[model samples]
Target: MGNDNDIRHGRHCVFLMHVHLVFVTKYRREVFTKEIIDDLRDIFASVCSDFEAELVEFDGEDDHVHLLVNYPPKVAVSTLVNSLKGVSSRMIRKKSYPSIRRKLWGGALWSPSYFAGSCGGAPIELIRQYIEQQQTPH
Candidate 1:
């Protein structure tokens, strides 16, 4: 005979979590073009990788951006968002897009705030699926 609790605890637990993140330009400015978006994507990926997360799907218009990311259990949402925004904004202004600095009158390419949500339960997967499906021609 064996203890049930001990047996249950013997298994390794892995949380397959996905999070959807949205970051917008300050005051919803139309600053991101195709070239800018591509540069930001690469910058985001490199930064996220340092935090033990992976950037899954990313797309955006001129004003805002949407990113689907998978992260390990140890990562905090705020830290992740802050790092992405801080680093990307700095890089974009300093190196990639200097015009943003001139237009914004400051060195801020992105807004100070961001939105992040976990996609574990409810209609999260359904929402991501819907976004994916929209790529098809109507």
Candidate 2:
């Protein structure tokens, strides 16, 4: 059985999927302010919604932002990340944010590489133990 609370009911299937993402500023520059982080939160949420996903949590320091996203199986994580990065970069810079664009070396706001990890599932050990305990009928 699966965790009822976490599973999302789709038209044909019940599933749960989550991924934690981290995006760092290009060259690791410490340039974000409170206002910038807030903007990023809204931007990411919007992007997630476009893909039928939810941004469960969002926060950041000066140079990096962390996101916890729950998404449907149809959405590819790479595509989602690409949109999140591309749209946010364009929107935030094109706005009246003068200091941010100047701080970046190039037109890009985020680094090319990012960190993504699967989360919100039972540990592997527990699954192994359950399998081991299963009875084999004679």
Highest TM-score against the true fold, candidate? 2
Candidate 1 Cα misplacement greater than 4 A, ranges: 1-12, 96-99, 120-138
Residue-wise C-alpha lDDT for candidate 1, range 15-64, written one tens digit per residue: 56678999999877887888888988999999889987889899999889
lDDT of 2 by residue, 1-138 (tens): 356887898899888999999999999988899999999999999999999999999999999999999999999999999999999999988875766767885688999999999888788888899999999899
True lDDT of residue 10, candidate 1: 13
What is the alpha-carbon lDDT for the whole of candidate 1?
0.79
User: Which residue pairs in model 2 clash with each other?
Assistant: none
Off by over 4 Å in 2: 1-3, 135-138
